[model samples]
Target chain A: MVEITIISGKGGTGKTSLTAAFAHLASNHVICDLDVDAPDLHLILKPENEYLEEFFSGHEAIIDQNLCSSCGECLERCKYNAIKETPEGLMVDLLACEGCKVCVHFCPVGAIEFPMRRCGQWYLSKTRFGPLVHAQLFPGEENSGLLVSLLRKQARGMAEKENYNLILSDGAPGIGCPVISSLSGTDLAVAVTEPTPSGSHDLERVVNLCEHFKIPVGVIINKFDINLDQVKKIENFCQDHGLSLVGKLPYDHAFTEAMVQAKTITEYQSGDLAEEIGRIWARIEALAQLKKAA
Target chain B: MIIALASGKGGTGKTTVCASLVRIWDKPVQAVDLDVEEPNLALYLKPELSGRLISEMEIPVSDQEKCTACGACSEICQFKAITVLGEYLLTFPEMCHGCGGCLAVCPEGALSLGARELGEVLWGQAGEIDFLMGRLRVGEAMSPPLMRDVKKRLDSSRDVIIDAPPGTSCPAINAVKDADVIVLVTEPTPFGFYDLKLAREAFTPIGKPMGVVMNRTGFGDAGAYDYCRATGLPILLEIPYDRRVAEKYSQGEVIADALPEFRGRFIELAARIRELAAGDLKEVSNG
Candidate 1:
């Protein structure tokens, strides 16, 4: 199966909107939202969870105040400042805690218990289009990269079991851990970006990252009509880098309106938006087929 | 007085606002470019900081001559950056958090520390403002280390304005964690509403008081404005979508330079932020 990940140089460049549209156009695919840190695809797809799974990300330190542990020994050992004394007790911020367990290990009174913090929940759900895989990380809790990996693993397994031909994954912005995890073992990557100075600059950054992995990449310039000169610059960028510029969608309120209605652009109006997305998918399939033949 | 320019979502005028804010301020201000990875602040400021390079980060590297086939390094790592396979000590440097746990536990002392070039922290001056920018070495996995190093140079006496990275992730955390006040710059769109929730989640834990700056004011219902109203967070500024701003940004000119009127506007922004941050920061230390 071919895996296609849609990633933008930065966020809020209509990456999710494009992912939603592709989810609607690609009927024979399992959709996975890999932007687990701050997932937004679920806002449009509205999945009806068919199966729920409790996944253990990592361990978190908890202070057992009943053991009479006001010795302040744990505070000195912690380098992350994760452990703190509160009026209620010694409180640990789950987000700040990297699960190092230094406080727990150093607790002289044996008052610390280290256990798995269920930072987020992963789900296998059904949407209007097809089977979907997604997850949500608790607010302010870290380990989003782990959550993204779990959802992608489940989606790949589901695709194999159901004989699905493709997996469309939406990746987070930037070249961070989550973005790296999403790019691993992918067949192709579709880098979505705008025609602004920052957009072009950041687009080159993500492209260079994909280059390091030697992953095949494609580009889509959203709202290309906004800046005609920047459009030329982006096209030139793609040309110099040998990445295909697949589709250029005009600046339209329909994309935003579809989002407010919690519907994909393809679902809202299947005429122009869907046609453009359909063309992109056809190119992806053809490229994948060519690779398979080679 | 310290003000931080941050965006819940990426690529929404954080750097642009910081450059503009520093350009118009009358007093000497210090600009801290806290976006470690892919820091584009220098691209805008064009300051001379060639000689200021510091590589003070060091993590554990194994000396195989004295190494044993034990799994101590892999066992103690909290970031899961290290994995052991008998005699093979596989290390993924990007995931390494540099906690120095494994080094302390290695009985053979074969696990000596080695320095890796994670990124560079540059220091210079722009006009009257002392400028500091961080550029994460292209492939460096660890950003918080260099971010902390940048935080060390913050001139608390001056009006310190930080140009934070985008998104509400670890990089963003390193950018705005210690700021006396945070100004979340966002556009008016569904995507803005989506990541705004994440941005709010990021700061509430650190307990930093925040306000919102709605860029491109009339693009939509200004969902961010609605969020600000609901949460009782004040809207700091409403910068309309004007061609002049876009043209100036495209030409690599700061907003205050493009429109002289905006210089006074940013100066006012700094003043308002000073009042808010000055009051809240005192509470932060005591609380």
Candidate 2:
């Protein structure tokens, strides 16, 4: 199976919207939203969750007051400064705790309890397009990379079991842990970007990351009309880097309008934007060596 | 006071707002870009970087000669950064959270600290504003550590404006955690409104006061406004959607410099942020 991931180093540059559009255009593909921290693909795909699973990764140090001797040993040994001497008693600040478990390991009286943190939830859902694998990381939680890998694995398993030939994934913003997890091992990494300086700047970083992983990249300039000069610069950069310049989408309110209506651009209306997206998907399929939808 | 500009969704103009506010603020504010991964604040601030330092995280280095392969070090690691397979010991520094647990649990004292290049921290001056930012090494998974390294340069004596990364996860939280107040910049769209709520949910537990700056207004839905009203999150400022502003922003021009008319708005935003931060401090002291 060929796996294609849509990513943008900068967020909100039409990654989710374009991924949803590609999902609508692709045939026999399992959709996966690897932006577990703040997933938006579901807003358009309208997935009805078919299976749910709790995700537990890493460990959080919980202090048991009953077993505590108030020796301050755990406090002194904690590197994260998560152990706070509060007015009530010694408390563990959940936000500051990095789940290192140093306090649990070093506790003299065994007052610190190390339990697996329920980071978030993953789901296998049914969308109009196909079966979607997505997940959500609880607010203020870490280990997003692990959760992203889990979702990607589930998508691959589903594709194999269901005989789907394509796995289309929407990756998280930023070239961070979660983005790395989403980008690795993908057949094609389609970077969706805008014409803004920030867009091009971040796109370069994402492209560098793709090159580091030796993954083939295709560039799509979303909102290309916002800055024609910047678009020329981006095009030149792609040419200089020998990266595939797949498509350019104009600045259209239809994207947001369609999102407001809980629909993809293709589902909302078959205008220039939808047609452009279709062409882009065809180019991506060709680049990934996947058979085009009949 | 430290004010953080963040949004759950990216490209909602956090860097634009941050750079504009720093330009118009009436003091020598310290501008920190905590978005180590793909930091773009420097593109707008145009800081003349005077100093650069490599930021490194400590990972366990094993002494094979002294190693017992007792699996004690690997057993204590939460990230599985270290593992013992048969008689060989392996270490994956990329996966290490730099918790130092393995070093502590090593029974034979075979594991020692080793540095892995996380990124670089650069500091300089942007006009009167003190500028600092972190650039994470490409392919590096860890960012919070690098972000912390940048924030270590925060001068509490001066007003600080931190441009936080997008998303309501650990990286974003680490940026805004120590701030006196957070300014959430977002557009007025369904995605924006939805992620705004998630950002609030993520940051609310930080116990710091938060406000919203509605950018690209006049288009999309009113869901963001309604969310703020319902959550009692005060709207600090609203920047209407303008092609001219966007064009200038695309060219790496600060909004306040590109359009002088918006200077008054940024000035107002700075004043409001100060008031909000000061008010929170007063409440804390009073309580």
Query: In TM-score terms, which candidate is top?
Result: 2
Q: B1-287 in candidate 2: lDDT tens per residue?
A: 88899999888889899999999989878999999898899999889999999999988899999998999888888778999999999999888988888988888989998999999999999889999999999999888888878888899889899999888988899999998899999989889998999999999988998988999888888888888888888888889888888788888999998999998989988877887887742221100
**Docking quality level of the chain pair in candidate 1:** acceptable
lDDT over C-alpha atoms for residue B130 of model 2 = 94
After aligning candidate 1 to the native by TM-score, how far in Å is the CA of B22 from where it should be?
A: 2.4
lDDT (Cα, tens digit) per residue for candidate 2, span A1-294: 999999999987889999999999999999999999889899888899999999998788899988888899878877677899987789999887888878888888889888889989999999999999998888988788889999999999998998999999999888888998999888999999999878999999999999999888999998888789999999999999888999999878888899889899999998777988899899999999942231
* TM-scores, chain A, per candidate: 0.93, 0.97
List clashing residue pairs in candidate 1.
none
TM-score of each: 0.89, 0.96
Question: In every candidate, how many clashes are there?
Answer: 0, 0
Number of the top lDDT candidate:
2
Model 1's TM-score against the true structure: 0.89
User: What clash pairs does model 2 have?
Assistant: none
